[model samples]
Target: MAHSRGKRRLRTLVRNGWISDQHGAWPMVILPAFVGAQLAHRGSIAATADTLAVIDPVLATSLPITWLTGFLCFTAIERWALTPKKRRPSCLPAIITWGTIATTTGLITVIRSPMLLLWTPVFLPLFVAALWEVLHRRPRSPLARLTTVTAASLMLPVFALGVVGAPSPLRTTPELWRATAILGSYFVGTVPFVRSMIRARSDHRWEHASVLWHLTSAVLILLATIWGAVSWPIGVLWVIIACRAWAFPRWQRAHGPVKPIIIGMLEIVLSIVLSALIILA
Candidate 1:
């Protein structure tokens, strides 16, 4: 009976596009989450550990639940948008998604982390805009994609602040917003680079523009790091991104398109490296 129930759950996840097809979404959430948590702990995992020492591990562990909640929330909205308009209500996915959201919110309330609550004001409008985009079934516009990716990037710091028990934007340090920009730059820059590489490959104008965009991004990140807006390690990431903008597309030209799985793996590695550096910074 338990085995059959597990199979049913697995089938539901697969039917809802929540399984392997969604692998690309994880790093987008994970990296920023790491950056936020690290920033909240001031780049020290030990600091977070020391602070969480007094708190319940259940709450500490609920960090991942927040990530799941965010993903489910977005996925639900997407699914809701995709559902055909029928007079007969057939909204099982939406029901499950809302159930998950409610359960996650209960856990968060129990945890008593206010950082996430503070961020909700900023997160809600962006989320609604995403829903609107999907509802209209418009092709993913660059600006909309950028906005969504940038919003996902912010989740990390918010979750990180919660992990370290930082209260409701009480401190408002330079590091707070700096972390967001530093992380936001990399993910948002990918929009142009990706366009130049895969989507707009034959368009010379866009390709050149993409290269220029990445180069400018690298230079700006370098200037910001030199100005001490963010740590030097993050600047290293920009250098790599700049090189990717210039080189990765060429490699793809010769190799005939890198597999999505391979790209996802590389991104995971990049995320790990970034997280490690921030933790040690």
Candidate 2:
């Protein structure tokens, strides 16, 4: 009976989208957290340690909350949005996740970071809208793209504030703002290339669209490098990304990364490397 009960519990977790898949979703939180922390530390190990001394618990508590937020939000959208029949809510997962969000947000409040709490309201609606797009099977919809990109973009500022340990105004640090733009662009830019990859596959027009978008990005990075707006390393990194976008379709047509998950992993690696290079630069 105990064994059977454990199986039942596992089934519940899977049904709620907590334990079923591995599509690199967690990186959505991780990349921003890493970049934010790294930027906050400014590549100084001592600074990172000092900040971590106070924020360690908060980070530990928040990681799962962030993941659960994405999981439950997406699950709710998948079941409710675009369906004629309303599916029953995953009550256990919903309760646990909402409770965690509340607890973590409250902890941030105790730390006196109001801006962090502010993210809750802004992100909730965006997540809903993004998930709605996903559920409606409209990956290329403007509304979908806008909401998802906006949500992903916000990660930079939110993470910066989290690492800084204070509720300073946006302008207090120019680097964080620049980091926000660079990281946000990286997040939002994925939408077109990825949508093209899945929705258009080997279609020449879509392939060309992806290639053009990436090349344009590379050119912008080159300009930024020339202007000394960013380090030369970033320009090189952007070129690498542009090359991937340029060559990926042809590779896919022949070799088959075949699975969306595989493509997602590639993107994750690039994002991590880009974030690392930004920090090093």
Candidate 3:
């Protein structure tokens, strides 16, 4: 039964301009409507409420469009660059790179200085690419990706608790401990889990990508938590960077990683600038 369904789905995709082996090989305006809705919900309604003391019809009207565009962007990236296990490139390099990013982000947040703020934007691409590994078409165990996301999500809330429980703003004791605990936990928990997930990946292209992508996101998550729990809100840039994963090339290029690396650095710089301005203001 499963074999037949797989065959059917493959046929449908191939007929519709999808490549035989790409992850999201067909161009689609993917509508991850739910997640998209969540992203715009709070901001739009809040903006509207502050004006008319109620929900603005204009804001509500734009919500679905915002979600559709974002989803389609991701879909386009997937269809172009990714494929299944049979045609995968080297997953090790990508996975290792993302892992390093995660570890570094975790380290920065824990032993945080202003430099950590510079790294906030790179978090997004790292994260989204890794997730594409899992979410894209491949035989990798989605369970592994699910595990990483679930555990990490739980840690974010835990860190928030520590922050919320901190001394009142009137007090002199700065809330550095929140950073220490959350970043530490984020680092420690992520390493073992990512290692385990990578081991479990079936050497498929998408699986390998997912492993790398998740590791990157895990690091970004650490940065985001630190900003949320202990420092300035420069982590918002991290979210933007992660979203850039939807623009990844169809395969990991063996040539210079010039473009991606440069983009990543640019994001970090943007975060630094934003942070500096906020602090100065």
Highest TM-score scorer: 1
Report, for all candidates in order, the number of backbone clashes.
Answer: 4, 0, 17
For model 1 the local lDDT of residue 222 reads 87
Would you list the rank order by TM-score, best first? 1, 2, 3
Q: Between candidates 1 and 3, name the one with more favorable TM-score.
A: 1
Error of 2 at 96 (Å): 5.4
Task: Name the lDDT of candidate 2.
Answer: 0.64
Q: Which lDDT tens digits does candidate 1 get at residues 136-226?
A: 7642666567667877887766665666565545444555566666567666766676666666777666667768877887888789889
> lDDT tens digits, residues 188-263, model 2?
6676677667867856776776778778778987898899988898888888888878777777777765578777
Local distance difference test values of all predictions, in order: 0.64, 0.64, 0.35
Q: Candidate 1 — which residues are off by over 4 angstroms?
A: 1-12, 17-20, 41-59, 83-91, 94-99, 102-107, 204-209, 228-231
Q: Give each model a TM-score.
A: 0.75, 0.73, 0.25
